[model samples]
Target: MERFKIRVIVTDQDVEKVALDVRPQTVEELKEIVRRHCNLQYEFNMMYEDPDFGNALCNLNNMDEVPAAATVKVVPLITSVSPEVTSNSSDISISSADTVILPSSSRTQGWPEVFSIPNFSVDVEFRLRQANLAYLKDNKTFKCPWDIKRNILQVLSEEIYKFDTYPDENRLHEVARALIGKHPCLTEAGCTDGCSGWKNSLYYKMGNFRTKLRKAGCAEVSINSSKNTPGVSKGLKRPKRCEVNFLPELPEREETLEAVRFLLAEEMKKKNPNATTVASKMDQTFSLRRREIVDVETPVETLKERWPALFTERQVFSEFNRIAATNLNDFFEALDRYTPKFVSIFKTKGGGVGETLTEFLQQIDLRKQDVTALRTLVLRGLPVLLGDDPSDFYKTCSVTDDDGVWAQVSIGLLTVVDEDAPVGPNVIHLEPVSTAIIIEGSVIMDDLKSLPEALCILFGLSYALHLDYPKSMKNTLNFIQKVMLGLGHNKLPPKLQSLKNVLLS
Candidate 1:
């Protein structure tokens, strides 16, 4: 390895001298050394005199270009406004070759003696006290150092008078503009045409440096930890809202669940315990509908892991799907059978028959009788698929059609259903209604002045259920329409009337 002796000079004063066996790899390493020796809050431009090029900073990246011995001059980007020490101090040199240099004032609080800026040569000390910036007085071109890019923060922390402690956010804009006006270098890059975009830069710089000073024990006590610290609010929390599921809770379809369980048990009797072999078999079995069921979680993964032998040649997945499909098909058949009976009940309650979704919506008025009749009929039909009462989940957000009622309903559904978590057989279509409504963008509005109560409930439920279980609820919507047509001012049956009262009341 090559070796070089180097001398670092700060503003014409010798600050450091060292012998290096390994040359610095990048300009940043040189900057780091300068920071260690000079305690400079702002960055410096490390320039050297080149024998052939006259004067310039050597790119350390190309080792062949560097000389055996070099003299590096440190030029501060943002010169200190005032020196803490007088110009004639001979003890300005900090000669410890390996010790890290820190600002004299950086010592933690309670030292009894307040530390300020360290002394420097008379020339450098006097130059800082003058009104003009050091670079401008020397007529040198601006070499914008990365570190000094945001040093305005340190200036505001140490020099600004109105701020007795850390400045509040309210004064940030004013301070930023003032600092930019005072120091031209603080102006944002590419803003040379009378536009100084330094406000954001100064604001962020000051905010970060304030925190740094506090952690370094250099921040003022008044602004450090007061309860009434400006720009910060204490003891505030986010507001809470009452949330209820829009889909009602229903009794479990025990017979249907039992059938599904029975199918799985039969499949387990045939399948091998090996997970890999069973997974391969399933992959081949569902090749046609593979895409649809690809992401579906295998509910039997735990059982397969614990007792892989029971799954030997098992048709668990196929049988479960077959049973579920059969149950769903049976539900549609029942809807076909019981639909006419419900239609008879609806007609006796005085609801109008509508051919289209729009017609149904326009006719439904928000009368107690109309709402009760429609709600009762829909709830009755819901049991065909759900096999239980869904009244509890009928809650909705305050927002109506315009704001998208399904949005709130979906949120409620997600809260109730942990889709990622494993569930047992009792988990019935967790968000069927809400999921369908969300995808279809359907909602029910209580617009008594324009829309009718019977039609609103009819279309709302029909659209939601039809979208949720398209194949199973295919004819259910038409059944609702027929029921509405049959309702023609005849008195409601006593059972339906009581049910209507339960809904509307």
Candidate 2:
């Protein structure tokens, strides 16, 4: 028996040169030799570079057939038991380490434990089966046909849409890696991991798929379509700060659009409406409302006339629940929980803004103030901290001149009063007085107790009516959407991330 050296790669940074006395007769024998040499105690799958496919790593099924001096990669299986793991004979365990964690800031958050690829069409499956059989018979590299690849992508795109309508770059790569892992024969020749090409193809396929979905009246994709978002040259309107049920499908069978609309209208007419019934009707009519708001781009006045209940405080919170899937109470509780930290962070700054924040903080006795007052203070100070001009977001004008100011304002917190309360310059102190949320120069929600409530309702209405974040308060709202409410994309902007890091620290 002649001795030869085979390079074993345990990880990207870990490689070992193993001396084999003789060619292993089976894959188990090869694993035993690798375990002895590398001192690996855990069960791991092996993939050896195949000269037949320009040295791309292929699953090492038969050690007897493996080429001499092959480079073998050892992939460790996840020790934690999960239902998502596929126990199929052909399935290889994808290491947790292999998954690319998005947004380096959030290290704990990564890809799902299992990336499930749905079955292809019958015809496509038949073709793939034949190709896979050929590859198994004589080590033939399966050249994926265009039609077969298209069908595979179609199925995968559908699966991706089930999670997110707009999957990021890392997500697309994860899907491609999962595809090649399940179907090793589809590994691209000359590629390092064998799925770079697949990733690129998937990116384009997703774009094409979204285009098709947009044309087919998919409200989620349609809202971000080019035609809907004119003048948005840089980026389309998408869920940046949260995973909103932007445009959910209409309720099936029992709850038709007309039926739900009628039910909702009847409930709205009640002097003291049933909260539970109103909430259910609002949820049922989510798709209908989304269509009018997103597709039709209905005016605020018209929307109020059609869906009057939507403007009510109860319905505003209900709409938020439908879109964000979070309770209004929970939002306030979270705001209250983080108020002290935010206040501390704000106090650390020393500048004009800091000085202003100091004055704002001094006006409110932290010990004496209720949760609502603290939350209001924090919300007001947030825009200032984030360097966002609060003039547009939180507007203050006398009751006499309110009509002119409301007309000019697009969306914000509007405070109309008989007399100017002397709190401080540029400071709108939180009072138990009536305030309103102005959208498109119209008061959609009114008779709010404080700024925080108005802000929460305004944030919810932003989603309900598909309105963009106000330019002046973009950062502040984004922070609220991403950090406070915990809705939106994983990757926070640098400014927000920095603030988050400080807050977390």
Candidate 3:
């Protein structure tokens, strides 16, 4: 057996040499050996010089690939390193000026879980490094300067905006907690959790930050400004569900609002407009349309006149993709995937709702039903099962009275059933059933093939036109938003969680 000597570098001053009797097959095996020899406890990455690339330091993944007398550098994965920790090796040097490498775990465990925080400015990084050093060296709480705190808040607010335009208290707390977790030196000594004060500061900072963003023509924040939402509260115009791009900023270096509007109008005039171009233009003008609908509260008719392309099915899906950052096809696929499980769960119930669900199931041939019909059953049955009154959302009426029935519904499925078909207490044989989406007492989309399609279009219109979920179908809509679409940021409500548990089980 031959022994290979390897040099392990922890820091500029800390180096250890070890002899290996047999070559380690994997990186983990080598890491274990280095960790034992150096007594290293912190998570770190091992970098070895690659002779092929001017001996540049590269991540050590395969131990067998290491050169015969390679020197490995151990880089601790830390967010804020104390200034006392120094590195002098030319390949990997650490200084007060360089940005500290953040731990990979922080990406999953840190605040604003949906979005990653942007790198802090060099000045802010220097301040954080100093704060960490002072706290570690003096063994006393370090107070962050006001300017540094402000800059930190600014960076955090920008990242939060990517996930939500107006983050609520819960969201704010997550950011605060993450800050302290990453840099314990910044924790407030007076607070019980050491983060409450930070959370409060973040709340106020976010308000001011939104104001600044609004001034900069950020449509997402501007739509909720005091001037835009009158008589209504700040949250009224904000996204009720987790909408990642509820109203994104206008495209960079694109045409002005008026110019985009002109281009959009011109595009609508073409008999065979390019779909790729149309989608691109529609994406560019999303924020503007959102402003008109949410801020101006423009009437649907007026909006249709102004943005004719928006009412089309293609644009409706496109607008939904922009708001939720999800594809409609994936949404339907999820709905279908869970339909059988949902039906099984619904069958176990034993109440008025259960009986209703049973009737619904009886009407449909579960084994032979198409995906559309299965989805329709799931979408319609969900409201009833969730205790949300579906009388208003999924209304059934004869062909003669559908117009009156549809007119009464603000937003929901208007199923036109056959008048002559056999009707039971809660069962109506749907033959050649037709479903339409009623928005603001108007059928914006008619002859929808399935109730699920109508529901999808209605959900999209809620974001596209800035309409609220109808009071009667709030729970069902919330289920689709949170569970089906997977847009929720918080824990599911009791009933929703219960259903989710069963579905997963």
Return the top candidate by lDDT: 2
Q: Is candidate 1 or candidate 3 better by TM-score?
A: 3
Report how far residue 263 has shifted in candidate 2, in Å: 4.8
**Residue 302 error, candidate 3, Å:** 2.6
Q: How does residue 447 of candidate 1 score in lDDT? A: 26
lDDT of 2 by residue, 410-500 (tens): 8888876657565334675667357888888877777888888788888878877778898999999888877876765467788899888
Q: What is the TM-score of each predicted model, taking all chains together?
A: 0.20, 0.65, 0.69
Residues 9-81, candidate 3: write the lDDT tens digits. Answer: 9866578999988878888888889988996534578999888898889998887769778888997654443
lDDT against the true structure, per candidate, is: 0.36, 0.71, 0.70
The list of candidate 3 runs beyond 4 A from truth reads 1-117, 130-141, 214-236, 247-273, 398-402, 417-419, 422-425, 428-433
- Give lDDT: candidate 2, residue 264: 81
Worst 10 residues of 2 by lDDT: 98-107
Q: Cα-based RMSD of the predictions, in order?
A: 25.5, 16.8, 19.8
The 10-residue segment with the lowest total lDDT in model 3: 101-110
Off by over 4 Å in 2: 1-152, 177-195, 211-244, 248-256, 259-263, 398-402, 416-420, 423-425
